[model samples]
Target: MLGTASPTRAWLLVEEPGPWGAGGVPESRLGPEVTESLRRTASALSARLLLVRRPGQAREDDGVRTLFRVTCTRGRERVLVRTCAAADVAAAAADDDGWTERPGNLLLVCTHGRKDWCCALRGRPVAQALAALAPDDVWECSHLGGDRFAASVLTLPTGWTYGRVDATDAVDLVAATAAGRVLPALARGRCSEAMVAQAADVHARLALGVDDVAALRPVAARRDGEDEALWHVDLADAPASAAPGGVLRVTVRRTAGSEAALLTCGAAQEQHPPAWDLVALVARQLPAG
Candidate 1:
């Protein structure tokens, strides 16, 4: 699941403390017209609409809802919150007022069972584990893609999505994020970046032994003109005492999996998802200033 993270730079998480259908928001109790309007708003903002709730069976509608808009625009990451009724939540997407800026990060664990059985089976325990550590920061979110990679966790403001996470390591993962470091082993990719950039970023992080989430940023990515399988990506490194102006270049090849299989529980047929392989990695020094 290296480069399989969903590609979305912005996210609109609506607090819907109730059951979610296989289709998530559309199937939730948000009503048909409201759901469509929310979908349009999300599409207009290039954001994903995720239904989120506090962990467990405390599903009583209190006539109040919290809406969060998180933007993972690389260096300009930020989270905005708005409190409004469920009926008026969609209007908050484009509205410029009444939004409070929030700091730190948000942990979203997929527990939308209707979407896929694996999610409910594996995601809930992980969510419980994480919420135990950071009650205010953790949420049971709707489908996060890659159902086969259940127990998927996404950290907001940075858009770092993790896959195949276990309940035992949930605290470690959240602690790592709080400390501004990344657990590379379970990372799927950052939702804000393209697939090639995601693959390259992970490869660069591993190759350089850098775990800090802010240590490297994707500077450029391009596909080979002659070969669709080849991609070239460059990452800009943050200033450091050892290497002030450093850049890392990564080359990756995209190929199909050796065998097709069921990627999600809801799928009726099997297919092969694209796989990214690291070809080469090189670190270069910038010319003297």
Candidate 2:
């Protein structure tokens, strides 16, 4: 799951109190017109729109819903919140004036069982466990991709994602996130970056023993030569003994899997997913002016 984080940097999480269908928002109670409108608005903003519901049986849509708009841009990360009648969700999301900036973060657990059984079976427990620790900050959300990586969790504003997480791991992750640090062991990648940059960022962090969320930053990424499968990524490290210039470069290669495998329980046929490999890592210091 190294570079598998969803590629969107912006998200519009609309509270639906679902039992969402396999298609997520489009198949929910919000009918085609509203869903289409929302899809258009989200697409215009380059945002991912997902349905969210509170954990447990007590959750019921009371006509009014809370919405969260989050952008995970590296230096300008922010979360905005607003409450509106369920019918006005699309309008509210498109309106920029009424939103208020919110502090803290959100933990979205993928539990859309209709999309994939592994998600509901494995993700529910993680969501419940997380809600027990921070009720207001956790929600059971629709499909987040990578179904085989069940019990997947996505932290908002930061866009840090984790997979194969259990109840214990959930607690630790919440604590780590609250403390503004990333638990690298279970991390998939950050959604704010491209796949190559995500893989390189994870590698750089572990290589430098850096866990602080703001320590290692992706400076630039580019395809290597004419090969689409090869990439070179540069990250700005916090001033450290390893590099006086605080720069690290990582090279990565992408390759298709050798064999097809059952990736999701809902899949009709086996499929092969691509893999990313680290080619080289170098820390270089720049000349002083």
List, residue by residue over 1-289, the lDDT tens digit for candidate 2. Answer: 7888988899988888865776755388887788888888888888999888898775545799888889999889999999999889888978887899999999999998998888999999899999999999999999899888898999989999988899888678989899999887787899998988888888777777778988768888989878888898888865476566657878889888677867887778998888778888888665587
**Residue 187, model 2: Cα distance from true site in angstroms:** 1.1
| lDDT to native, each model | 0.86, 0.85
- RMSD after CA superposition, every candidate: 2.2, 1.9
TM-score of every prediction relative to native? 0.92, 0.93
lDDT of 2 at 251: 88
TM-score of 1: 0.92
Tens-digit per-residue lDDT, 108-191, candidate 1: 999999888899899999999998899899999988889988989999989999999999998789899899888888889999
Looking at model 1, the pairs that clash are none
TM-score of 2: 0.93
Candidate 2: lDDT of 278?
Answer: 85
* Candidate 2: 10-residue stretch with minimal lDDT: 237-246
In terms of TM-score, the best-performing candidate is 2
- Where does model 2 exceed 4 Å of error? 24-26, 226-228, 258-260, 287-289
